[model samples]
Target: MIILHNYFHTFPEFPPECEFKYAPENVSRFTEAMLSGNLRIIILSLFSFLGHYGVSIFVFVSGYGLSKCYDHSGESKWYIILRRAIQLWKWLVPMALLLILDRYSGYTHFTYAYLGNNKIWTDMLFMLTFTANGLADRFIIAGPWWYFGMAFLLYVIYALFLRKSSDKVLWGIIAGVWTLLIVLSSLGLDNWVFAFRYNSIGWLPVFCVGILLSRHPVYISWRWISLGVVLFVLSLFNRYLWVVSPILALFPVAAVLPLARKEPLQNVLLFMGKLSAALFVTHAFVRQQVLAHDQALPPEISGLLYLLLCIVVAWVYRLCLTCFYKKIHL
Candidate 1:
C-alpha cells in the first residue's frame, strides 16, 4: 500500500499502457502529506516488505521438502516423477480458468499478460517435466512462477546427475557452478554472458544443498549460523542479479537447517509448507481482486483490507486443499 500510494499518481512501476499514471516525478516523497492527511508512512514500507520477503523462504522450504519427498517415497524415480506431474494438473486447471476469466474480461493488466497465453501449454510441459529452469534460461521470464519452473529443472538435474554420482564430486560441482553464477551475477555480467539466467542457475545449488543436507543433517548447524550472517549482509545491500543470490541464500540452509527438521517444528513447518504453493499462486490474485481497487480507499484502510483478504484467501485455500487431499487419500 505504501508502494502503491507512493506511485498512485503515476503508477510508474508499470508500462505506459497500464491503467494508472504516476504523480509528477518532482514531488519530493509520496505520503498523504499534502493530500488525505490520514495515513502513516512507515506502515507502507512494512507491508511492501511482507509482500516480498516470503518468496525466498518459500524457495528454501521447497528445496528441503523435495529432498524429504525423494527420501520417503521410496518408490521408483519414475513413479515420483509421475506423482508430481499429476499435481501440476491440479494447479494448471485453476490457472487455466483464471486465464480464461482475464482474457474474456478484457483486462489489460500486466498480470493478464503474464498468465494468459497460448504458451501456457509449453509452460505446463516445462513445469510438469521439471525442465522450466533450464528452458527458462532460454525462454520465458514471466514472474515468480519462474522459480517453480527453475525448481522443477533443478530437481530433474539432481535426479539425473547427483542421485547416482558420488556425493563428493557432485557437491563439489554443484557448489562450484553455484558460486560462479553468484559472482557473475553480482558483477553485473549475467545478462551479457548468461542472458540473466544466472539467477535460475544460482538456485540450483541451494536446492542441491538441501538435498545434500538431507543426506547428512548433522553437519549443517554451525555452518548455517555462520553463512547466514554473510547472506543477511549481502541481502541488505545487493539485489538478486538474475539468479546469483542463490548461493548466498542457500548457504545458511546448507549450514543450519537440519536443526529445524526435528519433531514438533517439523510438523508445523510441513503444514505451512504445503500451503506455500497454493499461497504463492493465489496471493497475487487475492491482492489484485480484493486489495487493489478502481478507486482509492485510504492507504491504511486499503492495507487492512489487503491483509485481511490474504488471510481469508489463504484459509479458504487450505480448506480446499484439505478436502481435495482427503478425496484422493493423499
Candidate 2:
C-alpha cells in the first residue's frame, strides 16, 4: 500500500476517481470477519483476503527471534529493550520522511486522512510512542501499524513481567489474560478504546503464543499445508469476532514455523522475514499508485495489479533496508 501511494504520487500519470467515498461500513464488517474466521485459515486468508494480515505472522516470528536471541546471549534487559526501540526508530525515521513526502505530494490528504487536522497530536503519539493500535482507533482503522505497535507493547510487557517468570506461571498468566480479553470482546464489554488505543491488549494472545514458543518449541512437519487448509476453512465464516481470530491464528504458528525450519531455505526465509515489515507498510501505497495512474482498470484487475506490486515493492524495500542497515553505523 505504501509503495503504490508513493509511486503514483511521483508519477501522476493516472489520477484516481477522487470523489470521497467512505467505506467505514465495509471496514467494520471486514474487521469482524477477520476475528471470527477458522483458526489456520484466518492466517492464510489475510494473505489473499486482504494481504495485510500475512505480516502478523512476521510480528510473532520477530518477537520469537528477538526473544530467542536475547535468551541465548543473556543480554542485559536494559540493553535489549534499547536495541528493540532502536530497531523501531530505524524503520520509523524513514517512514516519517515518506509520510511527510506523501502528504506534500498530494498522494494523501493530511486533513481527512488523519481524522481531521486537530488529531495531529494523537497521530504523533502513535508514531512516536508506538501506540499503533491507539492510532488505528483514532485515525486509521486496522492497518499494519497495529501489528508493530502491539508487538512493541508485548515485548515491553513480557520483558518486565514474564522474561524470567516460570514457564508455568507465565503461560498461565498469558492465557488467562487472553481469555479475559476474549470474553470481554465477545460480550461487547471491552473498553475498545482502552484495549486497542494504547496497544495494551488486542494482540496479546498472538504475541504470547510466540513467547511460549520461545520457551517450548513445537515439533511438526508439513505444517504450512495444514495451516493453509485451516486458514481456508475459517475464511468461509467470518473474521470479525474480536477475540476468536487471534486465537484461531495461533494454530498456524504450530504448523508454519516448523515447516519452514525443516526446509533447507534459511536465507531466503530470513530475507522474506526481514522485508516483511517494509512490505507491510509499502504495499498499500503501491496499489494506490497503480489506481491513480490507470484509473480505468476494472477494480478486479486493479486488485490483482496491486498484489503483484506488493511483492515487487516488498522485495525492493527489503533490499533498501538491507543496504541502509549495512551503510549506517548504527
Candidate 3:
C-alpha cells in the first residue's frame, strides 16, 4: 500500500483528454480525476485513499508480535527497548547517510545540535533517533521514517506501562482514547494529538486491539465480516469518521487477507514480507531516480517499473545484510 500510494501520487498524470486541474490534496479534483473514464488512473487514485490501511496493519502487527513474545520473567524493560532500537537502526542508518551524501559533500561549519548550520542533519537525527513524528506529515523528503519514531515510542509505552496492565484495563484505555480522539476529531481540532492518522495516541486503540486479539484469538465469522463492512461503509459518509478512516481501515484488509491463505500465494507473501522493511526505507530514493530518468514512458508503465526496481533493491539489500551477518557469525 505504501509503494502503491506513493506511485499514485508520484506519477501525477491525468488522461490528456480530461483537462482537469487536480492537486493530490484536492478532494473534488480527486473525484473528478477518478470520473475521467480512465481505469488505471481511477484505481491508483482510489488506492491513495485506501492505502492508509498499510500503516494501521503495521501498528497492529507490532503490538501483536510483541505481546506474543514479551517475557514476564526477570528482564529489564530498557534492555528489550534497546534490542528493538538496534533492530530498527540497522535498517535506517544507511538511508540516512545516503540521503546526506546525496544532498551535500561540500564543507560547512558545525554548530550546536547542527540545527542552523545544516538543516539536513536535523532530518538525519530525527530518523536516527526514531523521533520523526516531530517531522510528521511534512516529511515528504525524509521518506516514510515517521513510523519508526512513532513505533519506537509505542514500544516504550508498551514496555513501561502497557505490559503490566490487565486486559480489562487495556480495554478501558482503548475505549477512553478512542472516544476522546473521535470527539476531538468531530470538533475539527487542529492539534497533532487529534490527528488520528499520524500520532501514536491516535493509533493506541488499534495497537491495543492487536494485543487483546493476541491474548484471545477469535474466529472471523461471517457476521463479524458483515459488521466490519457496514461500519467501514458508514465511516465514509461522516466527516469525522472519514478523517479517521485508517483506524477502521483494518476491517477491509482483514476481510480480504484471508483469501490468500492458500499455498504458493502464501509463500510469495512471506518472501515479500521479509523485504518490506528495506522497501519502505529505500523506496523514496528508487522512486526519485526512476522518475528522473524514465519520464518518456507512460505513467502506468513507469509506475510498474518503479515497483520492479524497488523489489530488486529490497532483495539485494536483504541478501547483503544476510551475508554481512553470516560473515560476522562465522
Candidate 4:
C-alpha cells in the first residue's frame, strides 16, 4: 500500500486560519490552473482531460488538510464547522452583493442560460444550506457553489466521524459508502446519486484516502508516483474511472513538491492560492458579464482578460477585508 503520511506533513493544512498564508507546496499546477481558469499556459489536451476531475483533486486535498488540522486541534466539532462556514461567508458576502447587482443590471440572463430558470432566493438557500448539489438545477446564478456546499457537508461528516467513531469504524463506513456508490452507479442510479453533490460518494473514497493519509502518512516513493500517473491515464479513457483520478493525480503532484520550494514558483503559487477562493466565486460573473458580451475580442483573449479581472477583483476584496478588520480592531 502506498503511504502518504510524509507528503501531508510537508504541505500546509486546508481551511487555513489565515486566507493569505502560504499554500501547500504539493498542490498541482493543473489544479491551480483549473481554479484560476488560467488554461492558456497548458499546451496539451490534458487540460480538457482533467476538466471537472480537477475539482475532485481539490476536494480530496481539502479533506486531507482539514482532517490533519482537526486531528491536531482540541476544538469542538461544532465550533470548527461554524468557523468554516463563517470563513466561507467572508468570501461569499461580496460575491452575493455582486450577483444582486448583476440581477438588477440585466446580467441575470447570462447565468440563467447556464443554470436554467430558478429564483435567486431559492438558489441562495441552496448555497447557504450546503445543498447546492442536491438542487443544482435550481442554482441559476452560481452552479459552482455546489462545491462549497458539498465540501462543507463533508467537513461536518468527517468531524462527526472523528468525534464518534474509531478509525477502524470510520474506514469501514467509508468503504461501505464507496461500495454503495459503485453499486448504484452500476445500476443506472449514478445520475440521481451524483445530482446531490453530497451524494457523489465516488469522491468519498478520495476524501477517505486523504483522511487516512493524514493519520498514517507514508513516505513518497517513485513507485507510488508511477502508479498514480497510470491511474490518471486510465481515468482519461473511461468516465466511470474518473472517481479515483484525484487520488492518482496526487502522485505526480507529490513528486513536484520539492521544486515548489524554490523562490519564484513558491511566490506564484502562494499568490494564486490566496486568491483561489475569490477567483472561484467571481470568475463566472466576470465570464458572463465581461467576456460573454465582448464580441470584438477573440474567445482566447476574452478568457485571458476574464482571468485577469478575477485576480484584480479578488485582491481588492481581500484588501478591503483586511482594512475593515484592522479598523474594527482599532
Supply every candidate's count of residue pairs whose N, Cα or C atoms clash at under 3 angstroms: 13, 35, 1, 4
User: What is the Cα-based TM-score of model 3?
Assistant: 0.85
Return the number of clashes found in candidate 4: 4
Estimate the overall C-alpha local distance difference test score of candidate 1.
Answer: 0.51
Tens digit of lDDT per residue, candidate 4, span 1-330? 001111112123211110011123323443443455444433222332234454666777877788778877899988988988888887777667656555667544543244434477677766776666665344445545666777777778777765445678668856686566546656766454455334444456677777778777889678877877787666544435544455666776777788999999999889988877876676665555664466586544654565667678778878887687688872
**lDDT of each model, Cα atoms only?**
0.51, 0.54, 0.68, 0.59
Q: Specify the poorest-scoring 10-residue window by lDDT in model 2.
A: 13-22
Per-residue lDDT of candidate 3, residues 200-250 (tens digit): 776787788888888889888878877877786666545555544555677
In the range 115-162, model 2's lDDT, one tens digit per residue, is 335545456566667765654334342134555566677778766765
Where is model 3 more than 4 Å wrong at Cα?
11-37, 71-74, 105-117, 191-196
Which order, best to worst by TM-score? 3, 4, 2, 1
TM-score of each: 0.64, 0.67, 0.85, 0.77
Q: Candidate 3: lDDT of 137?
A: 46
Best candidate, TM-score-wise? 3
Q: 215 in model 1: Cα distance from truth in Å?
A: 1.5
Model 2 reaches what TM-score against the true structure? 0.67
TM-score of 1: 0.64
